[model samples]
Target: MTERIYTAGLVVIGDEILSGRTHDKNIAQVASWLQVQGIRLSEVRVVPDVIERIVEAVNALREGYDYLFTTGGIGPTHDDITVDAVAEALGVPVVVHPQARAILEKYYADKPGGLTEARLRMARVPEGAELIPNRMSGAPGIKLGNIHLMAGVPHITAGMLDALTGTLEGGAPLLSETVGCWTPESEVADILRQVEQAHAKCQIGSYPFFREGRVGANFVVRSTDEGDLKSCVDSLCDGLATAGFDFTPGGI
Candidate 1:
């Protein structure tokens, strides 16, 4: 029997991202972080700040994957409404989290414009939710069921992810080995297909590139089992060699 694979979906909620004013960086960072946690980032959706859209996306993603995460629209501004939207989607009432409020009060106690109403807005969350630590800022991330609500700032998201490391139950982290060669992907497509078909536990991705006026491709083979990954990689290398192609071990 095969081990169960854990998966996660991410929802990016922000008008800025949709408008192209702020380049979204959380998807890549979160995907990388989830892999380290032994969970696969299976799908991602970007929705605008509109509450209806957020609610729709939140409900869809939360239901489709084992875990769901959202970033953006959790700030103090009037337009920030992720908390409210998520609450609606979860069929829960929104309330002020005492701990989150306390964290904010302490965080802004010494700063100017201390704990204003706008800033206090960060403390709101869906009832029955827990807080994810955010040491960078006083406002903590929200966690309700399998839905994780994090900040939009890349660095802040990184900190939140750091706090979550080793906390969620997941499978083994995926491992990959890359083979870089100057052969055109189309030329070696048959070999790639055959090798992948032989390895039931591995997947091969072909990335074609043109640099220095030459065509080349890198094949990445991924699997959770190290022995299976190694066997698949060795077979692929042997196949390439048999076809008279030189390849790099890691990648170009």
Candidate 2:
């Protein structure tokens, strides 16, 4: 029997993000990566550094998705509290992992002023969790239950994701096809609605664009099932041809 596969959710926690001090680039990057691996990003939420909020979001998403990824609030800085929040969510105590500390120690061995108490704090993990290797920074990320906790910085988080990718399971790859319409969105709105009803499993999105003295819309059809995806795209193109709308054919 074919297994039912679904999407992943994300929770990014940090005061800097909520206060507008730091712009988040990790969510989009991770989303794109997961897409290539056949996993869809179903939801993403950002919260302040409050521990309770982090715990709440993690607990909620963990129950609903195949996997949960949390980036940010894992640093050694004073306000970094991802470890504690993850521990609280798992109902466990936070403690230092010797293997994680050894990795950090080796990473900082050559530096004259490295591996301070503050830096050692990065080794703290919720009891009975595994480490997510960080190539950018020596301090590793931790994974407990279904939650893959990661660093906030884009580079480190990306490295951790790379290290952990082999351990992840992906669902059906999302497929897409796009057709450009010479007509306005409103002119094609009714046709698009009919196409959606006909291909109920596929998602239809219209993107409007303007060029040199020309305006048009791109109707994109996406779905996890390849047969449904292609059928919907073909039907959409046929509809556009019937309406005499100038259209471009391409896959995304």
Candidate 3:
């Protein structure tokens, strides 16, 4: 039987990201997590804190992928309108989740300001949503159907991802092998293309880098099947050897 392929989309919602005030790290982190979950992050959209833009991105991505994850605009601040926008996109009402409220109440009980309205905003979600616990902070992540709402903070998002590790159903995890060479990528461009074409199931990505006044590249071979990945890597290595290029197994 042919193996299933699971895909996901990400919507990065924040004005800070677009303004270059806060560098977006969630994309790389989420993509890596999805890879371990056997889901490919097929698409990504970065939008500002505008509700209409968020709603448009949410609606578009949710319908196109098996899973959709949004990071940012879910905090207590006024700009944190991810939940409201997502609810609008899904045609649902935003409601305060009692369990989330209870969590916040308890978390802030010992603090100076106890469960103020601002903090209470974190408890709100789409009418039919579940909570993804955030061990790092009081605010919990939101989950509605295939849409996962997470924090923009890298550490908080990491905690949310940890909570969601085994809950998602995915296909075979993608496996990768890297080969590095101290030669310009253009020198072996044809070889890379030919090797990838011969292995229909494998993909070859060449990432070139300049370091210490020299040019080098790392060729990453990826496939869901271990055999296909290994075969592709071996073929590329053999081709590099025949071409009289010294290569490194891991990366340059």
Estimate the TM-score of every prediction: 0.97, 0.91, 0.99
RMSD of each: 1.0, 2.1, 0.7
Q: Give the runs in model 1 whose Cα sits over 4 Å from its true position.
A: none
60-121 per-residue lDDT for model 2 (tens digits): 99998988999998888889999998899889999999998998788878987778898888
TM-score-sorted candidate list, best first: 3, 1, 2
Cα error, residue 134 of model 3, in Å, equals: 0.5
Task: Encode model 1's per-residue lDDT on 43-158: one tens digit a residue.
Answer: 99999989999999988889999999999888899999999999999889999999999999999999999999999999999999999999888889999999999999999999
- lDDT at position 125, candidate 2: 95
* Candidate No. with top lDDT: 3
Residue 192 alpha-carbon offset, candidate 3, angstroms: 0.6
> Candidates 1 and 3: which is better by TM-score?
3
Best by TM-score: 3
Runs of candidate 3 with Cα error greater than 4 angstroms are none
Q: Cα lDDT for residue 60, model 2? A: 90
**Any idea what lDDT model 1 has?**
0.94
> In model 3, what are the clashing residue pairs, if there are any?
none
